[model samples]
Target: MLKQFCEHCGEETEHKEVIKQKPSKYGKSKKEQFKAFLSGFFGGVASQVGASLDLIDRYVVCKKCGRKKLENLGDEFQ
Candidate 1:
């Protein structure tokens, strides 16, 4: 399961899981697959947060529409 703030509406949204019709037989087990998905999702989040922090450290701000306003902190780190 994946969740994120919608860039257009700034609302929290759940990304539905996509189930394959034919999962690979040689692939990871169910637990491993779950873990991998979670790890990948969080990895993406971590990278985004890190990039945002890097921007703030340089006293810079993104001009991205709704994301900037939602992510901005007032002289503090999230």
Candidate 2:
């Protein structure tokens, strides 16, 4: 369990890992879908590059406050 300060509760609390799903396209046109697909592909590539370069910072949310905060875990070398 991860212990972090919660702004809402005003105290430190243990947090559970929350895995959120990427929202799906509900009512998009064909053209919009194509554009979104291209954008997602390029965005994924860019994120891969950033991850390999250790330029991405990951974070966890506070259990009580639901505040997303990055812990100082030093550099992540892939």
- Write model 1 residue lDDT over 1-69, tens digit each, in one string: 445555555566554332221232325788867765555456556644553233222212223332332
Each model's lDDT: 0.42, 0.57
Best-matching candidate per lDDT:
2
Off by over 4 Å in 1: 1-27, 46-78
Q: How much lDDT does candidate 1 score?
A: 0.42
Best by TM-score: 2
Off by over 4 Å in 2: 17-53, 75-78
> How many clashing residue pairs appear in each of the predictions shown?
0, 0
